[model samples]
Target: MRDTALGAPNGAALPASDVSAAVGLVGLAGLLAWIAICRSFPEFVGAFDLALPAERLDGPYAALTGLIAAGLPMVLWSVFVDKVHTRDSTGLDWNKRAEGQSTRAISFTKLTGLWATWAIIAAVYCIARWYWEGNYLFAMQILGVAIVPMVVLSVPYILWLDRRMFQPRDGAWHFGAFLLAREPWDREKIIGHWRAWIIKGFFGAFMISILPGGFTQVVNADFGLLASQPGALASALIALLFVIDVQIGTVGYITTMRPLDSHIRSGNPFLAGWLAALLCYPPVNYGLMSAGGLLDYEINAPGWQHWLAGNSMLLSLWGGWMVVLTAVYAWATVAFGLRFSNLTYRGVITNGPYRFTRHPAYVAKNLFWWSASLPFLVTSGGPMEALRNVVALSLVSGIYYWRARTEEAHLLREDAKYREYHAWMAQHGVVTAPLVALGRAIGRGRGEVLQPAE
Candidate 1:
């Protein structure tokens, strides 16, 4: 009952968490409002890069296959793991009735309010995206029929789930955050403090949600090329890479390692961690990335050749390099496995692909993008213009590089292992040693301040 490491028995209420959640809820509402405003005034829509081409709907099949294949197993395994952890010695689910009553501070009203707010945001995004894709009638149906009823219907369900799965019953929270009264030791522990856990869950759900669409991309590309394309070998290799990525993701989340118990926490709450994480994900990217005038496949079927033009040899080479990058990316993920999630450290992974470079995924991913983009293929502009566009498109890689630095900073602060890893990578990494020296030289004017992290 006495105050201890985690918190006091009668722990002071987390007003800060409440405030942060409230701010998040309000910010989401405002984002929805922006979508609505853009929808109502089409002129304003041009100012924001919120539009996605209706034709791009053709999708990528091989990528989709990877996502569906990988995602289902992870979800199933996570559920199985949950069941195993929540069971008692006699094989019963741990009871939380008393714990739910006394230890819980979150009430029904709070949970419902948060969910309802999210419902509004979802409804707005559905309408905005559909409308952007020029499907006005479908957008209307979603608003008039689906969003209205779902918001109304979700209240009771939200209350039930929050109580059963999500509410913090003891000091620890379940992945589903269910209410329980047993010893906190028995509960499934998430990686961070309660606030950070909430943030991680938000992004984790984002990762799961994108799998189907990502898989569809692979399906589209592989099947689309199967009949007409000459480079069957390249296509097959690409498909294999997607499968590897899925496998790596599943491996990371299943570990029982001490550091891998929870994903990493956000070191910088604002720009470095959460904001950067959001920018890295999709739908969100549809809004943030369009402004950079970077090269992307926003054009439809016939028009894509204008931007994506290349001979079969070039295309096959591009596909091959992409697969190689995906392999490196998968290797990184395999080491990270279940610990893999954006903006939070589930744990520091120093083995596997990481020993060769601190950021295998980022490096490989950027190279794959460059290969696929083929900025050398000018679509409609002069050589100078094409070069400028390529440079701009390359900035996308810079964004990931920034993300890598931020992640390093976060891990370095939280785990001394990361600092050691950084030093070792600078001196001994197969791929990173040269870059490390160049980076230090770039900052040579600052005086010899780069010392080893002890």
Candidate 2:
């Protein structure tokens, strides 16, 4: 909280986080308004209904309305209010633009690299059988429709941006040079390039795949009826929070534009970071954490709702607490604005829910799982089963802790600013300070020195 603790290099005060709470708030406001219109004015939506392709604005194309509602406002706020385009981090020098021929050459190479990357991702999608099944099928269909437009649009976009880029031979350019065999390229940059794209390609599809269900649930929710039923209300609220998470999270994945000052400076290159993150998502999670999977914690668990059935007072309190946890999880994503992806460092965020803890989402999510699932409260299973369930759930929480450590390791290595933030959090963070001290004490007792990964 002191100026000394938060000082930037040269002993000056650190600037506030790039993305503001207001940005996400405006987006949330827009989304709520859109949802209101959908629920209240079906005829109005149906009249000029081409954009509202679904009868209820809850289908895939219709779900994209939530993106526009949430994303457009965030974009406007970031550009107009935050002036993100003018940030030094964007690597743009508008006053000293490049010469036309140089810009053209650079754009050509970057385009080559970009196109090749997309082609490879597409090929992978085609070859991967999972992408054609279940929810992923919708993602493939959406990407298929957008591929032509994306390919055509990138040409002009690259050319325009290259003219003002301070250093146009960035990761994409390096990769292009390596592929063309026309010039030497940094192998590290090429690896970084692939790492960033691999994250975008993999997570982007998954995010898209899961978007429609929550959007539909929130839009069609019977709030009036849900209000009287504690269990139903909690589920609805949780679904809405998740809808916010998915909508904002998907925006973060897609809007990695330099002008927005939300470009991935580097992907988290640590293999532990990749492994920890990938294990939590997709086909891996399907096999590893499913009903009969290695980490199945819900063996005989019917969840909080079932256990607390007929007890309205207790159910209300528990449900309310669960909502609070889920809100914190959603707020953590909202805090990132247009820069919340897995396994990448777009920028250091030290605002909103982040000010309280280094990993608000992880902490809140783990707590929510424990509370909502109530691993010890199994119906058919007795003490032994309860103990097994608790142990399994604990291991799942341990995985999240592993993820947090890996992320910290990656960020601490990438940016001096992050190291400062880490140090500051260790001393002053609302939730992180105590945990840091406890960790240090435990390490000392074991005669082990635990330092942030360099």
Per-model CA lDDT versus the true structure = 0.47, 0.86
**Per-candidate RMSD vs. true structure?**
15.0, 3.1
How many residue pairs clash in all the candidates, one count each? Answer: 34, 0
How many clashes would you count in candidate 2? 0
Q: Give the TM-score (vs. native) of candidate 2.
A: 0.94
**What's model 1's overall lDDT?**
0.47
Which lDDT tens digits does candidate 1 get at residues 230-275? 3555555566455455434533332322211233344344366555
Compute the lDDT for candidate 2.
0.86
How do the residues 1-454 of candidate 2 rate in per-residue lDDT, one tens digit apiece? 3434333333333336768888888888887787777665567766767454444566677677777888899999999999999989999987876677867977888888899999999999999999999999999998999899999999889998989988888889998988888978899998999999999999999999998888888888999999999989999999999988998899889899999999999999899988899889988798688888889999998899999999999999999999999999999999999999999999999889888788999999999999999999998869998999999999998888889989988887888778777776766677887876776688899997454221
Off by over 4 Å in 1: 1-198, 214-240, 243-260, 263-270, 291-315, 445-454
